[model samples]
Target chain A: MLVAGEHVLFHRARGFGRDTHGASPPTVLRHSLVKRKFFRLKLQRERTFAPVRTLYNLNLRQSGKMSEKIVLYYFDGRGKMESIRWLLAAAGVQFEEVLLTKREQYVKLLNDQALMFEQVPLVEMDGLQLVQSKAIMNYIAEKYKLSGKDLKERAMIDMYTEGLNDLMEMRMILPFKKPDEKQAHIGVIQGKATSRYFPVYEKALNNSQYLVGNQFSRADVHLMEATLMLEELFPTILSTFPNLKAFQGKMRSLPTISKFLQPGSQRKPQPDDVYVKTVMEVLNIQIP
Target chain B: MLVAGEHVLFHRARGFGRDTHGASPPTVLRHSLVKRKFFRLKLQRERTFAPVRTLYNLNLRQSGKMSEKIVLYYFDGRGKMESIRWLLAAAGVQFEEVLLTKREQYVKLLNDQALMFEQVPLVEMDGLQLVQSKAIMNYIAEKYKLSGKDLKERAMIDMYTEGLNDLMEMRMILPFKKPDEKQAHIGVIQGKATSRYFPVYEKALNNSQYLVGNQFSRADVHLMEATLMLEELFPTILSTFPNLKAFQGKMRSLPTISKFLQPGSQRKPQPDDVYVKTVMEVLNIQIP
Candidate 1:
């Protein structure tokens, strides 16, 4: 399901001893690009950096192998894919991206029937072409068992996640806003977060450590990702909500999430001018 | 969470004996609204609108009773609440809508912290205040076992539902379009449905009786809803897609769905000028 020759595995291993999680020692998943064929991976013990060895290029879903990498299809920015990236990272799942750089690159995907709605942030996982940010996250969360234990808990998680998504969406479109209007847009995000959205989360955190259910779930992961995004915009965004502040620290300290925060991880930076311009040109559309 | 004084159960009985499913005879659920308190309902055999008697003023969630009606909070329109109405109707689950007419009504809900993101289409069910249309729909679908039985099936259902939602959203905004520009908007919908969306569903239907799993699921319900929506715009919208054409007919024949499609049911009409004006004033914002 990958656009040929455009695959690059966003490996978590910063080539050797990085942030190690509990219990299992980290194994490096090194993937080599094979055009529209199969995903080849070599599992190297930490700091091995062995010769380019080829192991089974097995289908992750077909083999029911949790260790194999997932493929993400999207443009080279953080519009919709950022949350997908967040969930995957939180699950400690390694993934590769087919970053569409040209209009033709995106259109080929359309012609291939790879995108259900002709939109990106499509993840090829468990033998399915996953689209829609919420759907993608829901699948990943359920796969990782971050979605709750029962139907009611999952429902609560979905509700809280949806609310956090509303807040994240306000910040997500900032890069697309006109430069002259950017400050006003930031003001809106700050105001909404402080007066409305943050207060809700703050109150929820007061009752439980996680947003939904007693354990960490998709809602908590989303809140953490959103918290980091908001912090990047205004460093003091969570200053008034002490619960959120403490929640932010606790979230950053999670083993998988902490690894994602490192310097060379797959997390894309805020949309720079070039990234935004490229997105505008490649999509050839304007968001109203 | 039944808001005081505004609860009216939308029962599907055209006074009983209307449409029967399988071997099970239809029973009538009659509701009487109580101010600020509880939902009181009486169960009667078909054709009996018995004298008002008080049953348990049940909290539907805590009592684990599925027969009790769910309460929906939204403006009296088919904006985001329409899909909800569709799912509930398809499940044969009766619901009451607290339709907001004034700006202060919505503002009061905000002040009361009923709306997590300051938006409506909130459903008060199972002792929880649920916001966000997708979350609410997912909860309902899962609770009614309309969502797929397994993770992969659920994922596929989610993916298909998301695609259909994209198409529905395009039509959803038409009510807000300028009166002079309405035709152009309709044209856009027709073009997108025939070109981008309908074909996908048509192809998916070509594969199975249902969109995701072997049985009826949320995706199937959404497709049925969207098909009805598109047909309203252009009668021949599905003429080119035989699978979808057949799918629509098959879906409407199901007992619950057949009842929902009946006239005098809770299915909302396309938003009128008054609905649009109230939405604009009550929300007090402009989209882009």
Candidate 2:
């Protein structure tokens, strides 16, 4: 990839960790800080703002801190954007989020024709504005060589990640469940995790320490992410799944994943009531 | 791709339509039927049945007709597997289905560990047991060249298809909606189809005749399928979206897709009462 008429080097998205691909760290990214009092909408690229939303004037003191890096646009909480954050962190890619705190910010994106489906976690990378979380994850996974190397290996990785996605999606909707129905929904999640989902991952891990291509891939990243997610809901979530526990431990010890696990990293804590309020307020939705 | 120790000559997965790739037919697939008055699942593969259920004795007279090609395992309805069927048909690939009508058939597959995640839509093709509907669709799409040619093009295709899928999934769960809630759900689907989704495709189609890579792709196929689905619910679904209507016309005029649309073909009609009943029984789930 070329930038500024020169071959740009990569440092795993210019992350805090070192690139495992043997690329030195000084090619694709370099930006000087520019501070002004105006609501400048140029996010490493030039764009005119419509002034239709208060978001254009919100405190953007952090923009210069993350200049020229991948820009992720979403709310201030862990909704659909969480998994993309997880995948990028696992790939050792550093990104910054333009958090939407008000409903007008989302509407501004829609009015500018920025979001394809009028929905986000919109990511700007490689000179492209990307939407759809799965597509973004696939792109980052492939770019980082975490996606499989062959067609068959890709098939296995796709299958495992997809199954884990089904499980994660169940919890992803927990905040929307009615208060009366929350318990039963949790029961359903627990039932499906143990009976339907966790067993498959456990069995898949039994044959090899890795999920796809017998090496670390996005599937392993997802498995480790999901186990920790379930553990949040139920502390002993992996009690019956010994292999998954061991797999989670092994995944956490990887260089990239281990760095991500450390404090002061980009990983967000689990969403709380305040986080939920900000998300629902920005998206303008009521709990179902 | 090799099959049976020989370079397999492909005819677009061996269908009624001609292969546009210019490969002569007949080097991989050939099977003679063995007539036995039992539920033998030797669909071009050697596997002994334990005979633990009535599915082992159910009528399977049509298995011989679809031998040596793809074997799709699902119920006789247009559920999640419908898009896979649409993709295969659009690719002009011939496939067979082992329809499940009884709970015991599902139990048998579960006992045999055929389903990786204890779910249906399991497919047998290219000597691999493929699970996860999206994974199966991706595999088939890439094999038949409905997927795009490069990474950027593939990203575009994946993005459009993912958006279309969000719309399609809203209708897919309608079968499980409560009797009294069905009307409201239908209203939601129609509202989202017209307001949220159609405009995106309309604008996308404004730039080119195709959705990705200036060629036919799985995204186009999915948009066509989704528009037809919405039209089934609302006859005037595409009245406001001129570009989408034209795109649909262009897609439907393709030789392979037009053939699949014809009557007396392998295409299943919209699900009626019996189809829903069979699916509910086989899966053993109450309406949520």
Q: Write the per-residue lDDT of candidate 2 for residues B98-206, one digit (tens) a residue.
A: 7776655665555555677656677777666688788888888888888788877888888888878767766765654446556855765675566557877888888
Q: lDDT (0-100) at residue B20 of candidate 1?
A: 10
Give the alpha carbon lDDT tens digit for every residue of A1-288 in model 1. Answer: 011111110111111000111111111111111222231122222221122211222233446653344777666667778888888898888887767666555544544556675556777766677787778888889889998998788878887887676667666656655565567557756765775568878998995788876888888889998888899988987888899989988888899999999998888888787876666545444232
Q: TM-score of each candidate?
A: 0.77, 0.77
What lDDT does each candidate get?
0.63, 0.63
CA deviation > 4 Å runs, candidate 1? A1-68, A286-288, B1-68, B284-288
Residue A179 local lDDT, model 2: 60
User: Model 2: share of native contacts present?
Assistant: 0.30
